[model samples]
Target: MKPKTYFLCTVVFLASVAADASLSLAFDKAKLDTFLTTNACKYCDLSEADLSGRELRGADLENAKLGSVKLSGADLSALPMEKRTKRTNLESANLRGADLTNANLANAAASGAYLREADLTGADLSGADLSSANLKDANLTDAKLDGAKLDGAKFCGTVMPDGSKNDEGCAP
Candidate 1:
């Protein structure tokens, strides 16, 4: 890991430990509102939020913490061809243990993202950039992942896009 990333993770862990027990794991209401209104929330903490079935295509969420967030059936895919500017940026975002069942994440830029143990059953992740992402133990049954960038991605115990179990990146 990069030094910066390591530092950030350490800081976040320390902060979570130092904070009050109740508020540390909750999503920030103000940040959530900002993201809902603007569709852009870099480095925001949206973890543990219930955002199922929301229209969030092309949202810019780089480095955001979405761990344990309920995004089942949400649309976080690419925008239409004519009206498009950029793809959804999930780079380095934390999506660990998220519920993304049937979510549309097609063509999103998710390089270096963390998605450990996420439930992604039937999610559409076609053409997305997943380079160096950690998908350990993630469930991708029936997911559409054609043309996705899988370079350097970790997939230990991951349920593949084709509904197969993959232990390619597992450690002994």
Candidate 2:
């Protein structure tokens, strides 16, 4: 009821809010790391988290938001290529040594993502946007590219899904 008491209560409330926010951030970070290490968070909210070198084999990550997250060297082979939307959002994310065989990535956005030495065999990339993605030494054997956009997508020693080389403007 007193003015001094009210002021002290307000300060305490503000300090508590700040502390709560910090704690929440810390907890989210810790949880993310734990999930990556243990491979527990299959369908969790991993939006905007750093997941480089994570082993997500056979994980159910359907409809997961990974906008602007770093997933360099993350093993995504565990995902079932058929009957699933392995269509990940890896814009500017590192994808070295990743396996994306037979994945349905139709209409996915992967501009500027590093995909050196990655495998994309039999993947359905129809109508997908792969601008500026590094395909150095990557395999795309038998992958679908019908109506797909490949503006500036590098193809250094890349293998097409149809057992052919992926030169610029080559249609199946």
* Best model per TM-score: 1
- Tens digits of per-residue lDDT, candidate 2, 1-172, equal 9999999999999999999887544226665766667655533455556555555554434334333344445554424466775544556656566566666666666677777777777766786678988887788888788877889998867887678776653343
User: By summed lDDT, which 10 consecutive residues of candidate 1 come out lowest?
Assistant: 16-25
TM-score of each: 0.83, 0.49
Model 1 earns a TM-score of: 0.83
State model 1's lDDT: 0.93
lDDT string, candidate 1, 1-172, tens digits? 9999999999999888778665655888889999999999999999999999999988999999999999999999987767655788999999999999999999999999999999999999999999999999999999988999989999899988787899988878
Candidate 1: clashing pairs of residues: none
- Residue 151 local lDDT, model 2: 91
lDDT values for all models: 0.93, 0.64
Q: Pick the candidate with the highest lDDT.
A: 1
